[model samples]
Target: MSVSSQHEGLCLRYPEPLGPQANVSYEAAVSMLMRAIQLAQHTPFVWGYIDKPQEGHIYLIFMTQQLPFPPDGIRYQDQEQKIIMPAGPGRELEVMEVKFGFVPNSSDTTAWRVRRRYRMHKGGHPQLVLIHYGRGQPMPIMPNLNQPVRNYPLRPINEPALFVMGEKIGQKVYPNQHSGPAERPGPPGMGMSFGGIGNQQAMLAQQNNNLEALERRSQRDRSGSMNARAPPPARIEDDDSADESDMMSTRTLALTRYKRNHELMNEVFMYAAFSRKKEFPPPKSPYSVFDIANVEARVAKMTAEIDELRSKAEARREARSNADGAVGDDPGDVSMEVSGTTEEVPT
Candidate 1:
């Protein structure tokens, strides 16, 4: 994946090694990446990819979100590489469970209070957990094994990345069919059921009673299904020949909303230094409102403030240490002594 040269510094890299056991199938990775792209276009924030290196190492890189496509009189770096086709919508996706906690430190109370001004002394990092909800085995999210999830406020690209973490699921959508799994098989594959059928001894006595009870339960389920609103119609995955590699064919992944990075808006203000044919330099951030002149200077001022605070903290610590040391080294008796003679009272 290529990145925007101007927004290069916006991303962070984690070179932690992902073990081979955490391998995500190629198709699932592609689906997640595609969803990430969709999220970047829709949301006005910084985002990037959790990439897998050749050795299957997990390397995460983030960047400022860019507009879905280049504005008029502007061209993107991968202009020719992007493909656009009319498509229905993304599937419903799952939201993963995010647990936040504090990182314990050994510093004393005074020092901790001082340090907290600049950063989160305790609650900065979050523990990622699997969203299995007890369906099967419990899965913990490790840097190497777990893939990053891309969530959108409105809807997902096909479905949420949480459900299709490692590989894609569900049937393929068609142009003119309902897209939900209305008649899919049961949880443990088709033609399977738990509990045994009644034997002749009890079956004969409760024949009418059992039939009526089963009929009522089935009716209730059907009613509940009918009452629920349906999503956009999609074709079912009835094609047995379609494998992981063949999925998502005849689908176009494109941006749903038009974000305003507004490259063309500034062209009116700046001098006509270059022709329209020349590609404009990418913005440092996605939104034009945040592109301020003194952004760098403000960052430097914050850094200076942090340094000053650090120095003050060190001074306080040094003074406390010196006072303690002097008290310990003094030769005079530290205990209070009672006076032997009493002084005359003054009027």
Candidate 2:
């Protein structure tokens, strides 16, 4: 028998029997055997193997749910008699049993049953049991072994791994194909089952397809591309007070006056230093021109205002230059100073 990497190296070369005992001493023997399996290399999360006298031959029953491969290439030899019980999946061992004589056809059985119970702290874990029955002996009452299941999202395992966790029940099985055994035997050396090893591979493939379909539907829902309606356009109300338009018109007139004042100021400054500067024209009416003393007073007020604006502009420019220098000195600081004065000089 060839050894497999997945289940190799864990083999026990027991010149000493792991369980060398009698049928009457079966309970004690199983207890000792279980402890040995626990200490063995690559001890599966939950598993056990025991030998007991049944009929004429020693019934070597090995049952496990966690191990990837069946215990193969491992054996017990009665050195005194030279009898060898080689290890293989159900071929050299009994397949597990749920109840005595429930379905007695194969010499070796490896059946398993799984039940899920909700846990307050851990959420959920599978309760797996593997029981094997020897010929003409009542099924042994086994202790419940607790193993932490990997609560991974259901996905298809490849052909090899699927064979390891063999014959999954409950949520582990997939849809399609009748729920029974296969017509022909599966691949060579693989166990006999509803669809053999191929059934498990098919079940995994179907599970993958189902998950892919669900993911596609979830993506479509997230994109909001299914029977969705666009939002309505925002509406504007035309209802406003009759004086609203009048207010806008007044604002426009004020802006026009401000612009005209700016143009007049520029023209006055342009002529201030010109040799051909025109003389100030008198108003068409004497009332518009005002008395000479009043005109002189208005000119004096305008000159004072111009001087104040120049002082403010120079101060603002100096402040901005200082701010620029500060910014250059401190790379992290931001300067937000106005560059020049912008006083609205009333005419």
- TM-scores, one per candidate: 0.15, 0.15
How do the residues 247-342 of candidate 1 rate in per-residue lDDT, one tens digit apiece?
222211111011122444556556565445687688666565674668878998999999999999999999999999999887874454349655
Q: Which regions of candidate 1 are displaced past 4 Å?
A: 1-285, 334-347
Query: Which candidate tops lDDT?
Result: 2
Question: What does candidate 2 score in Cα RMSD to the true structure?
Answer: 36.3
lDDT of 2 by residue, 194-292 (tens): 111234445334434443443343345434522364542342222132322322234333444587688989898877867485788766874765688
Displacement of residue 289 (Cα, Å) in model 1 is 1.5
TM-score, structure 1 vs. true:
0.15
The true-structure Cα RMSD of candidate 1 reads 34.5
